[model samples]
Target chain A: MFDYLQYVRQENFPHIWCAGCGDGIVLKALIRTMDKLGLSQDETVMVSGIGCSSRTPGYVDINTLHTTHGRAIAFATGVKIANPDLNVIVVTGDGDATAIGGNHFIHAARRNIDLTVLLYNNYIYGMTGGQCSPTTPRGANASTAQHGNLEPAFNISGLAIAAGASFVARGDAYHVKKLETLIGKALQKKGFSLVEVVSPCPTAFGRRNKMASPVKMMEQLRDTVVSVEKWEKMTGEERKGRFRTGILRDIEKPEFTAEYAKLIEKMRPEE
Target chain B: MSNDRPGKVRMMQGNQACAEGAIAAGCRFFAGYPITPSSEIAENLSVMLPRLGGKFIQMEDEMAAMGAIIGAALTGQKSLTATSGPGFSLKQETKGYASMAEVPCVIVNVMRGGPSTGMPTLPAQMDVQQARWGAHGDRGVIALTAKSAQETYEQTIRAFNLAERYMTPVILLIDEITGHTTEKVIIPDASDIEIVHRKKPDKDPENYLPYRFTDDCIPTLAPFGTGYRYNVTGLCHNETGFPTNDSNEIQCLIERLTRKIEIYEDDIIRNNELMLEDAEIGVFAYGSVARTAQAAVRICREEGIKAGLLEPTVLWPFPTKAVLAMAQKVRAIVVPELNLGQMAREVSLASQCSVPVHKLGRVDGSPIPPQQLVEKIREVV
Candidate 1:
C-alpha cells in the first residue's frame, strides 16, 4: 500500500465527512497523485471554499487556505499570480464552484491561469444539509427542493470546456485509479485544469434520493456514466439518462502567469 | 519607475498619486475592478506595477478583486485594491474576512453617491459610516480620509504602514473631487519615508501558531509556501488557526483583535485642529468637505466669529477624545459633510448633545462650498 499517511495531518485524522461519503476516496486519490509526482508539501498550497468537500484542505499536511464560500478559485488565482513557483490546487464542491462561485469559475478558466481545480460534484449542498445545488439533477429531492427539483442540472465538464480550460476531465470516486490518473494529468498541465469528480454523498444527497446506501449510490454512478468514446457511439435513447466521463478537452495556450512575466520583462526599466 | 531618485515634483491626479504612494510603500500586488472616480488608480497601477516587478490583475468583480488581494497578502506581499461606492459594497464580504484572518492589505474607497449606484461620477461622503461598519462583525478598521491630491499621496503610504503595523485592512477614503483633481506632488526620497512590514514568527515551523497573541496582542504571520504549512480561515479560530467552538476561546480571539487597536487608540487616531485654542465655534469635517471647511473657517475668523476647523485624518478609532474636548471648549459644533448628517451624528453623540450641533449637508453630488459653510457657521453662532 502507498504511504498516503505521510501526506496527511495525523492529528486531523477521522475527518468530518460522513460515513460512506466519497470525499475521502477523492482526497486519497489526490494525495496519491501528489505522492507520485514527488511534490514537496512545503511547496504546495491547497485552497478551498466553504463546503463539505472544502474541508479536505484541513486534513492535508500542506499550506492551506480555507476561504469564504465560493471564492477559492479567485483566491487561488491571486496565490498563483503572486508566486507562480508554488503549485496551487483548489478543492471546491458543486454549489461552491457552480452556484455562488460560478462567475469566478468561468473567469479563472478564461484567464487560463495555472491552477489545478478538483470540483467534487455530490449534486447537493451536503454542508448546508441537502439544499438543491446548481448541479442537482432535475426531479431530484433536496431539503430546499422538497417537491423535487424543477431546474436542469449543469454539465460541469462542459462548462469548463466552454470556458477555455486548457485541460478538462471527469472522473468518479468508484473508479479511484482512473480518478488518480486524471488528477495526475491535471496537476501536470500548465494552464487552468479542471477535474470534476462525481463523488457520492450518502448522508445528505443519497439518503434523500432513496439511494441511502453507499453501494447503491456507487452503482448509480457506475451504471449511468460511460467513457467518452463509448458515449459517442450510443444512440439518443441509450444516452438519455447517461453521462460521459473521461478527458473531454485538452488544448494548449499561453498561460496567464507566463504572459504576465513577459509583459513585466518588456515593461521593466533598463538598468 | 517614473522617478524615485528623491525630491522629484510631478503634477499628478489624486488617483495617480495614490498609486505612486502605494509603490513607495512597497505594495507588490494590486487587484482591482474599474469603477468611476477610482479607475485611474487601476490604470496607473497596470502600467506601474509591471514596470516595478510587481503584480497587477484586473479581477472579474470587486468581490474577486478583494479576495485576490487577501490571497496575495497571505503570501507576505503588500497588496491593494481600489473601487467606488457600489464596488466597495461588494468588497465588504471579503474585507471582513481579511479582518478575521488578520491579513494585512489596503483598500481604497473613492466616495460616490449611492444606496446602490446612486451617482457614479459625482462625489458623496455617504460611505463614512460604511467604512467603519460596512462589513458584518465586531472588528476594528483603520480608515484615513484625504482632502487633497497631495494628502492622498501621503495618506496612501500611511494606510499601508498602518495595515502592516496592525495586521488589518486599512481604508483610504477619497472622494470624486479629490480623486480626479490634479495637483503637484513632491515625491519624497525613499530613505526619508518609514516602511513597516508585518512581523514574522521566530519559532520553528513545528511550533509556530499563526494566531498566538504576543505582548502587543498582534500575532506574527508566516507567508504561505514558506514551510510554515499553517491554515488561514475566516472562522472563529483558536491560536493554532483551526476552528474552535469553545466560547472562551472565541472571546479571547475577538477581544485581542479589537483590543489591539483599542489599546493603541492614541497612536492610531489622528486629527488636525486649526485655531481651536480661542474659537467659540468649531466645524468638524473630513475628506473633500474638510477643504471647504478650512476655507470657511478662515472666512469666519476674519468675520470675527471665532470659528475653527477640526479635521480628522484617521476616521475610525473615531477621535472621540478630541471631539469631546472640542465640544466642551466651543459654544456650538458645526459638521459639514457631503451626506445628510452621517459623521455629524457621531459628533453629536460624542458631545452628548451638550453643545448646539449644526449639520450642514448636501446630497446633490456637488461639494459644499466654503460660503455655504460660512453661512452655516453664522447661523449657529
Candidate 2:
C-alpha cells in the first residue's frame, strides 16, 4: 500500500479548499501517482499559479514554487530545462491555464518540454468570487455573467494535442482510479504531457450553475463524459454536449531539454 | 575568439560585450525574446550559452522570459534576460515578483523611444524612471547605465555580483548608441574577474527556512533538489516562507525587502567624477549622454570656463550622495538626457533645490551633440 501521508506536509494542513471541493480528490490522485512511481520528494518539484487548485503545491512535501497568476507553466518550463534530471509538475486551474497563461500553455506544449501539467478545470474562476473564465461553458451562469456566458469554452485536452504535446489525456474527479492511472502515465512519458481533470467547485461554480451539491456536480460529470472508446461509437448528435475522457494523444517526439542537450554537445569545441 | 588569453583586445559591439560579460560572470542560463537594439544580446547568447554548456531559451514572450530566468535562478544558476522598452514594460509584473520573492536575476533593458513602441531603431533614456518604478509596490531598485562597450562589459559583471549579493533583480539600462556602437574591448581572463554567488543555507534541511532573515536581512537560499522542500511565493510571507496574514509579519517582510538595499546604498552607488576640483558649473549625465557631457566639459575647460562632469554608473538608489556633493561645490548644474528631463527631475530633487539645475533634452531619435551640451553648460555657468 502506498502511504500517501508520507508525501504530504501535515504541518501545512488543513488546506484552504472548501468542503466537498473536488480539488482534494485531484490532489489525492496526484499524490498516489507520485507514490506509485517511487519518486523521492527531494527530486520532485511542484509549481503552481494563483488559484484554489494552485494551492495544492503548498500541502505537498516537495520543492514547491507558488508563483504569480497564470505563469506556472512558464516557470515550470524553466525549472525543467535548467535541471533536466528533476521531475517537474505544474498544478494550474482552468482560469490560470487558459486565460492569462494561455500563451505560455500553448508554447510549452509546442516545445514539447518534459513537464507534467495537471490542469484542474472547474469551468469558473473560484478564487475571485465567481467570474466567467475561458473554460466556462457557453451558457453557464457566473458572477460576472449573470445572464449566462456568451463565450464558448475551450477544450483543454484538444488544445494541448493541437499545440503539439506528445502526451495528452483527460480525467475527472469522479473517477479517482482512472485519474491516478492517467497521471502516472503522464509522469512516465518523456515529453510534454497534460492531464486535464474536470473538477468541481461547489462554493463558487456549483451554486451559480444549479449544481449546488458536490454529488450533483460529480454525477453530471459522470453522465456527460464518455470513454474514448465509447465516444468513437457515439453519433454526432450523442456527442453534442458531451466530452471524451482517457488518453487522447500519445506519441513519441524529441523532447525540448533533451534536444537542447544534444545541441550543446555538438556545439562544444574539441578539447 | 580566445577568451582565455589575458587582456586580449578585440573589436566588439556594446551589446556583444554585455553578452560576453554575462558569460564571464558565470551566467549559465539565459531566457529572452528578440527586440530591437537588444536583439544582438539575445542572438549572441543563443550561440554562446550552448557552447559554454549553459541553457538558452527563446521564450514565447517577455513575461515568459522573465519567469523562466527566475525559475532557473531558484535552481541555483545565475540567469539573465534582455529586452527593449516595449518588452521591458511587459516584464514589469515578473520584475516585481522577483523583487518580492528576492530572486537574483539580471534584466537588460536596451532603451528605445516608447510609451508604446514609439521608435524602435532610435535611442532614448526614457526608461530611467520606469526602470526604478516600473514594478509595482515599494521595493528598492539597482540600475546601471553604460556609455561604451568597455563599461557595458565591466558594469554587466558588477550587475551580476550585486544581484547575487543582494538577492534581487538588477537592471542594466543600455541605450541604442552604446548597444549598437562598436569599439575595441579588452576581454579579461576568467580568473581575473570576481564572481559572487548567493549565500547557501548552512542549516539542515529539516530546520531550513527559505526566507529567514539573518544579519544581512537576506535569507540563505537552498537550491531546489537539495532536499530542502521549502516554498517560494509572491505573497507576503514569514521567515518560514509560508503566507501569513499577521500584520507584524507583513511589515517585517516588506521592511527587509526595501531596507536590504537602502542600508547598503553606500556600497551600491557608483559614479565617475571628472575635473570637479575647481569647477563652478557641474553637468550631471548618464548612459550615452554622459559621453557628450564629457566632451562638452573638455571644450568648456579649453575655452577658459570651469565646468565638470558627474556621470552616474548606478542610476537607482539614484546616487544621491554624489549629486548632493556636486551641488555643494557648483553654482549651477546642467542635466542632458535622451528623454525630456527625466534624470533632470531626479538631480533637482537630489539637490533639494539648493542649486540652480538646468534641463536639456532631445527625443527625436538623435544623440545630443557635444556642441549642444557645451552651450547648455555655458548657459548654466
**What does candidate 2's lDDT look like per residue over B151-237, in tens digits?**
899899999999999999999999999999999898887888889999988899988888987888987778889888888999888
TM-score of each: 0.98, 0.98
Error of 2 at A17 (Å): 0.9
Q: Under CAPRI classification, how is model 1 graded? A: high
**Model 1 misplaced regions, further than 4 Å:** B1-6
Per-candidate fnat, comma-separated: 0.79, 0.78
Q: Estimate, for each residue in A80-127, the C-alpha lDDT of model 1 and write its tens digit.
A: 999999999999999999999999999999999999999999999998
Q: C-alpha displacement of B116 in model 1, angstroms?
A: 0.9
- Clashing residue pairs, backbone N/CA/C < 3 A, model 2: none
Give stretches of model 2 more than 4 Å off.
Answer: B1-6
